[model samples]
Target: MSVPVPKGFSELTNLRSLSGFPVHVDMDASNSWCSLQELEPLSQLRDLTLYGIEKVQDSRMAEKAMISSKRHLQYLKLNYSASGHTIGTCGAEAEQQQQQSVTEEILEKLCPPTCLESFILRGGYVGRRLPDWMCAPESADFKSLRYLMMENLPCCTQLPDGLCCLPSLEGLTIKDAPAIKRIGPQFQASSSVAARGSTASTSAPFPKLRNLQLIGLCEWEEWEWNDCEEHMDVETAIAMPCLERLQIKNCKLSCLPPGLASTKRHTLRELYLYELTNLTHVENIPSVVKLDVFDCPELKKLTALDSRLQKIRIVCCTKLEVLEGVPALDSLVLEDPTMDTLPEYLQAVNPRYLKLDCNKKLYESSSSPGSSEWDKISHIGKRDINCIEDSDTSSDGYSEED
Candidate 1:
């Protein structure tokens, strides 16, 4: 929520932080609330958050805020309130187009300072394209930025192409963006380099990025990175060299991007996939040490060759058939109350510790010596088999009883 500020608020020139500053405009000049122009004098602010940016009448009003000149500011958030707007209604098409244009113009003038390290964009942004400063050539302005998050972008169809060129970015999160159906090659390399057919470049995309999370992108179905090789040497070009952890939830992608498994094969260590209904296989990511998969009923194959993998947890993946190629696995956890017997893949890999949650009948059989179920898992050094009623399980299949 935004708090109304007095028109004279700018008099506090020594203020170091300001949050929830409201930007509200009235038709009558004398009746307007505090305007963006008032923020021009608060140059000492290090943390700032501006709400209702969509209310600014024009780009000039946004420019008056002089946000780019605040060299000391390190954290900034720009919010666009979608409270009163409704999509797909009568006469809404033309009105939405006009709003999108105005919102784009307003954001262009609200660019943050170059020294800013963290930035967030919240609420519904109506603009079809991000501001110019967030794209090519101009993107170099964010040389010091380390983290960025965009939440609830309902209308954006694509991600900013220049994000791959951010040299200092370490963490990125994009959530609840339903309109994005695919991530194209432009998101893996600079568009300028791809357009010029450059044989070599000094830096790779996402050179320092370490953690990435994508959630609630229900419509996303494809990720394209192989095409980037057409413009650069496949053997020499590298992307996401420093990435270590990746988590994806509620997406429709059938397979992980080829470039990710091929390029990040040595650095990526942890991977988590949840509710990816269309995915069928997980393979070739030899660097991953910990893997978790939940509620992916269609997944049929899981393979990694000569990996450093140590721990694996799988829950509710009913169709899984093959699990192989992890030569150094140490622990394995499986939870499913419906299974009547042990899965065939248990004999393929050898884990020192094995844990299972199953129906009472299977649990009792596995606990008895010389039984078929017990013989199948007898090779494991340590085993803990429990009936469903004896263990407490979370929605994602992880048992709290462990």
Candidate 2:
């Protein structure tokens, strides 16, 4: 059997399955034949990924093609810089100008794309604000959208207000967006939205949201509900009732959001904070079953965690001096400890499985295995560990430091 290559996609009126169509668009110069306007021919496409678009002008044509195919599109990923499009690294003003042009083109061509469950915009000149139609529940055709990721958009500033309307939205990630200093306006507990309408509606809360990740945000100063008020209280804001996991990396956040405590320690099950350099506070890690903090050199303590915390892994915090409050934890992993000995209180936690490696203190303690209280509930060991510092280790029982 021979696989026949159609002379050019141009002659085909209806190609049934164009797997990996625009994602790796057969941009082999001579082979590039799918007209940008006639993508509807691939009517069965459930997933469409576009990658490495070099020229900025090509994106305008591609945007139109995406909108046209939205009806059958379940997953859409637009990656603009495999050719290393320099629009992102250029000065903010130049990037802004390009985004404005791109935004208008996308907006004009966009008609509520339906059936989309996940939409991702990666490495391109995205405008400061996403179009209103994209955010509006009434306007968007994607009723089942569960994941939305926007990465490396240098010009984007805020999330759309219609975020609350996404009934199925489970995960929202904003990464490498240097200009986005805040997560929400009306969504925050304290905002002007409360004054104009029901405060309850503004804080409708992420009923299905399980994971929230913010990374590489340099200008982000604070994440508090009712930031406009003189004080933000955790007790007032609605909680993330279903949130189970949280991961923050390389973001210069001063501390955890103040309203997280208001969640009443009800839903949070796993927490990972890494490379947060200026982080000085760790007040509320509620009912967390697993916690991994890595490469946070300035952290002075791991504070306010509940007794139910089951697993704790800490690495390379040169200044970490205390782990006094965590209790009822089943597993304790300490690697590359900053101090010569484990914190005095850590020896007393009730973890059933304990692993220690590479730290001179834990290594010394390994010889005198029965000397500490941790020996009662845990199996302590001294071993050489090898793993990447930034990789996620939650599933295999390991996490990277920073």
- lDDT tens readout by residue for model 2, 1-402: 112234355345344334334423344556634545445455656666655433335455656465555466677776656235544545597765775676545544543365778878776645666665555444224458899887877666766656555557789887887886776544432222322333344343455678888777767666655322233344324545567788888867778876665535478888889888878768666678788888887888777787788788887776776676765766777666344555555545545555654443344454343656235323333222222223433222222221
Candidate 1, residues 1-402, lDDT tens digits: the string is 566675788898988998888887655667536778889999999999988877786888899899999989999998878774334567688987887788788888999998999999988777777887777656766889999998888888898877876779999999889899998887877533632234546567787889999988989999987635455554335677788899999989899888876633477889999999899999877588899998888999998643689899998888898999888999998887878888889988789888888877887887777899888888887887767843555312222221
lDDT of candidates 1 onward, in order = 0.81, 0.59
Please give the lDDT score for candidate 2: 0.59
lDDT of 2 at 26: 48
Model 2, position 130, has a per-residue lDDT of 69
TM-score of decoy 2: 0.74
